[model samples]
Target: MAEGEEVKNKQVLFRNYIDGFPKESDMYISTGNTIRLKLPQGSNGVLVKNLVLSCDPFMLFLMRKSDDSGLFGCYTPDSPITGYGVAKILDSGNPKFQKGDLVWGMPGITACAGFYVVSTPKKGETVFVSAASGGVGQLVGQLAKYFPEGIDIYFENVGGKMLNAAILNMRNHGRFSAFDYLVHYSQFYDILLPFIREGKIVYIEDVTEGLEKTPAALVGLFSGRNIGKQMIVVSRE
Candidate 1:
């Protein structure tokens, strides 16, 4: 396609701020949009086509109507839903990125920032990580294992009364932690890519093809329908 050409831009629109668990009916696939294959003058944006869309539980928080987290803001109604994703840039106004570059704005420095950085962790210290099989927790646990001297893990998913109990036991002036406070995607990828190449890290994908199927894929996440990381394959071009 020419640099100034436009192509149909398909999207998954959030129906509205949701109630309870989400259903396939909560999102709508839009096909009426078009994207120009060129960058706007003086813009710092990179125009790209989505390739892989990650589906994680945190997305549900943004789907709620009363969010005040100010971390990841709410997904607007009648507009595209948001999450981490890999895309191939078709146009660029940012010198740090260029056309045809397959870039991803995404994941898992969470455990490092939360447990290792904010919370104190030491070599040989036994650690408890919740959601040990999910994305961040799994990596956290794995990273714990990678410590050269070895670290013991007490992995479990604690919630409800257990969560309250844990909170109640917190020491006064205990440190609280937050991730994504300052995002450096390049740093994240730099850390991950080496581990990936060395086989020290691996990714699990529960992939669904096409933009239209994204809703069902998201809804199925509640029921644990997919294995590994749930993602939608929007394009492989």
Candidate 2:
């Protein structure tokens, strides 16, 4: 360490373990646990300079104490919060990555300090993001547009006329999914069931608020939430 040099980090910290549903009060933000410019010589990792952090609904589910399914256990209470983000690399011992490279991926808790860390976004296929302007929605929207065929592919929003337009413009044999921003069960079932039942849609995907609440997530999809691909943001972000 040199004189006048300083190390500081700002992070979201958990205040306590949560059970059941959580509110904003369940967490807090603090400044601490920063790192130096250099890491261990033999360590195989990249030190990232974060630019953006993605706050997602799924991050909420991970806050649960018993995610033996290998989900929530990754998070701990009263610790520096970690989630996916987009970042630039500042240093690396890993051959696959180099400083100055941009990537969007998950950075393990404390994996990189100073700047936020993330993996490179995945490649391939068209992605339709609902509420595309939202925190998580924005990242997905950009990715869909950047995909090789983004220009040719349609990026649809899932509300009012947007949903109708997306469904109408979809390529034949193409798969369609959705992100449920509104937690309404009846509207989905009563409003969209006809289109789905008629094969106007190939498939659907969603992350809702429950297991017992699954019925509602699928209420509009027919058959009480058809069973191809379904999920919900079961945690707090």
Candidate 3:
């Protein structure tokens, strides 16, 4: 790919707002799109080549024409949709990133993305979440390993057995929490801050703060407006 080369940018476009369960017919994949491979003049954006596109359930919520789609907002009637994706930067106008940087984007917490895409966690299931002094959420950094067969992110911490187990027991949208191997003596409650920051776990699950925002927050539980356990705080005191 040369500089400023244009490539076919295939996309999925939602038909319209919905009232119930979204079906395949509600969205259409249009392969007739074209995108330039370079940044616009004076633009400071990075152009990425999406190596893997995750099909998540929150997209269904965004498909609805709603006033409260939380922080992510709603998808346009005829525009392309967005979700968690692993991609390589093809061009960069930002100083922090150079060409060929692999990135996993944000508002990307593990449990919420899981519950939406994979449904509820069950009893007798072996699930592990790592706590690096607690309060960790988001795809803050790219996991050290990338499985080319489409297991988008990974970091080896436990050992080869844990590593092999992860690779073998994979599913679409499966997420692994990061382990801070060095923190051996910290208390459990240290997780509150970052959780409060990015929104996850008990500190945040579909969390909507304040009284004026209560109604929309309530509606979000089943409306795809809320990400995790929906809670509205009228007052902290």
Candidate 4:
């Protein structure tokens, strides 16, 4: 569609407040909504066409109404569930962004523009990354591989057995970066893009087709049924 045109917005909506482990019944696809392509006058928001979405384990916590202290706001019942996505800007009222700008960031978080500094990895230090195959973990694993001592980083996504094993095998002075405890998205992309372009990183995605499968895909994370990065393909284009 052209710029400033109206389009139907397909969204995954949170059906109710979740408790314990969330089920597929907790969320549903709502495709009856339409949104204008342009941002309202005086609004600083940018309108975007989402291209890719990230499925992180932390999303389960946001689904729970009890967890109000999360850095990302809790999902409201009957509202569209929001998360990080790579998108193409369709229209913008913000001076920093314009139509066709490709970007990625969480719904409530501001996109990081300009350059971000990342710490240089020491030559021989071992790095342990939990959720190594997940969105963030995969990038961390690839970055660690670039060091002279290759694959020294232990990248894991799940806890329990995997985390215990990682702790048991950690070398003295080894560094551990937890996905839930860090905010290094910009730095991650900085290092990740090069590897991606060089074909150094191989990504495995477990995708469920259609927005209707979103809840099932999410619930599968807890059951260990998903392989690699779990995602929902809402559209082919």
Better of 1 and 3 by TM-score: 1
In what order do the candidates fall by lDDT, top score first? 1, 4, 3, 2
Q: Between prediction 2 and prediction 4, which has the larger TM-score?
A: 4
- Output the number of the TM-score-best candidate: 1
lDDT of 1 by residue, 155-176 (tens): 2243534233334444444344
lDDT of 2 at 82: 64
Instruction: Evaluate all candidate structures by whole-model CA lDDT and list the values in order.
Output: 0.69, 0.47, 0.52, 0.66
Candidate with better TM-score, 2 vs 3 = 3
TM-score of each: 0.74, 0.43, 0.46, 0.72
Per-residue lDDT of model 4, residues 7-50, tens digit only: 88888899887778888888887879998887888999888787
Compute the lDDT of residue 2 as modeled in candidate 1: 80
- Residue pairs of candidate 3 with colliding backbone atoms: 134-191, 135-191, 206-228
Comparing 1 and 4 on lDDT, the stronger one: 1
lDDT of 4: 0.66
- Deviation in Å, model 3, residue 96 alpha carbon: 0.7
The alpha-carbon deviation from the true structure for residue 150 of candidate 3, after best TM-score superposition, in angstroms, is: 38
Model 1, residue 35: C-alpha shift (Å): 1.9
Model 3: CA > 4 A from native: 106-237
| Per-residue C-alpha lDDT of model 2 across residues 47-92, encoded as one tens digit per residue | 7655554444455456666546243355677785565556777678
> How far is 169's C-alpha from truth in model 4 (Å)?
4.6
Candidate no. 4 TM-score: 0.72
